[model samples]
Target: MNLTEQVLHVLDNALSLQGRTAGFTRDTPLLGALPELDSMAVLALLTGLENHFGITFSDDDLRGTVFATVGSLSALVEQGLARQDP
Candidate 1:
């Protein structure tokens, strides 16, 4: 699957989102916009991404900008994969 689909899957499962994430688009608001996206959820998402993609996120890497939207999150994952490449 592509980054967006993979992220959507992770979000759906991690947050118990009940498949609601399928409606999300590139411009969809995150962070403060989604009530489900609380502090705990943010941490869970980071952990999920790290475990799923086999990458680690530093404190400086965990920023609101990376989780701004589905597109942004996918871009962050792509960047992480690039960094992991030999």
Candidate 2:
């Protein structure tokens, strides 16, 4: 799967959203929008992403904007994955 799909998978698994993410477009707002996206859920999502993608996130990457949407989070992870490439 691509980064976005992987992120969606991670999100679904992390939040146990039970396919609720099927309706999520790239612009789907998270953070203050989704009640499922609390701070703890964010941490779980991060862990899920890291584990599934084999990447590590720095403290600087924990900004609220990173979790702003499905697209934003996937973009962040995409950038991080790009940085890991040589």
Candidate 3:
């Protein structure tokens, strides 16, 4: 699956969104827009992403801008993977 689909799936499962994430697009606001995206949800999302992508996230890496939009979050994942190359 593409990044968006993968992200949506992760969000759906992590938040128990009940498929509500189907309506999300690249423009979907996440950081401050969704009430469900509070501190706990942010931690859940971070853990889910680390597990799903098999990557690590330092506390310094968890910036609000990274989770601003679906596209931005996906791009951050892609960038993280890219950095893993030898």
Candidate 4:
């Protein structure tokens, strides 16, 4: 799957959305918008992203804005992948 699809997958799986993510678009609000996205869920999503993408996020990279929207989160994943030296 591509980065956006991968990100949507992570959110869907982490939140147990049960394929409801099909309604989500790049503009979908995340942080404050999704009631399922609590602090624990946030951590889970971050860890899931790291595991799925094989990347690490520093404290500096964990800003809330990164999770503001589906697009932003996917961008972070893309950024993490881009930083990989390969």
Candidate 5:
């Protein structure tokens, strides 16, 4: 899967969305928009993304705006992938 699809997969798995993410798009709002995305879920999602991508996130890498939309999160993942490139 591509980065965006991978992100949606990680998010669906992390949040236990039961395939609800099938309709999600890059522009889809998360953070305050998704009822399933509470604080704990955020942690799970972060961990899931980190594990899946084999990239560690520093404190400075996180911000509320990063979770504002699926596109933003996908962009974060893209950056992480770029950082790990040889």
Candidate 6:
């Protein structure tokens, strides 16, 4: 899957959305908008993203702006992947 689709998949699984993410777009709000996205869920989402993308996130990388929207989260993933490039 592409990065966005992969992100949505990780998000859906992390939050237990049960496929509700099918309707989510890049603009979809996640941090404050989704009640399911609690603090624990954020940790789960980070783990899922790290495992899925084979990238790591430092504590400094954890920021509220990264979770603001689907697009922002995907961009973070993109950045992580970019950092892995040789």
Q: Give the candidate number with the greatest lDDT.
A: 6
Worst 10 residues of 3 by lDDT: 55-64
Expressed as tens digits, the lDDT of each residue in 37-81 for candidate 6 is 999999999999999999999888888999999999999999999
The lDDT of each candidate is: 0.84, 0.88, 0.84, 0.90, 0.95, 0.95
lDDT of 1 at 61: 72
Residue 36, candidate 3: alpha-carbon lDDT: 86
Q: Against the true structure, candidate 5 has what lDDT?
A: 0.95
Clashing residue pairs for model 5? none
Per-prediction TM-score to the true structure, in the order listed: 0.90, 0.94, 0.90, 0.94, 0.96, 0.97
Steric clash pairs (candidate 1): none
Sorted by TM-score (best first), the order is 6, 5, 2, 4, 1, 3
Q: Which candidate has the top score in TM-score?
A: 6
Question: In model 2, where is the ten-residue run with the lowest total lDDT?
Answer: 1-10
Ten contiguous residues minimizing lDDT sum, candidate 6: 55-64
Taking the tens digit of each residue's C-alpha lDDT, what string does model 1 give over 8-82? 888887788999988987777777777888889988988898899898877877777987888888888888888
Per-residue lDDT, model 1, residue 19, is 90
- RMSD of every candidate to native, in Å, equals 1.1, 0.9, 1.2, 1.0, 0.7, 0.6
Off by over 4 Å in 6: none
Total clashing pairs for each candidate: 0, 0, 0, 0, 0, 0
What is candidate 5's lDDT per residue for 1-86, written digit by digit as tens?
98899999999999999999999999999999999999999999999999999998888889999999999999888888898999
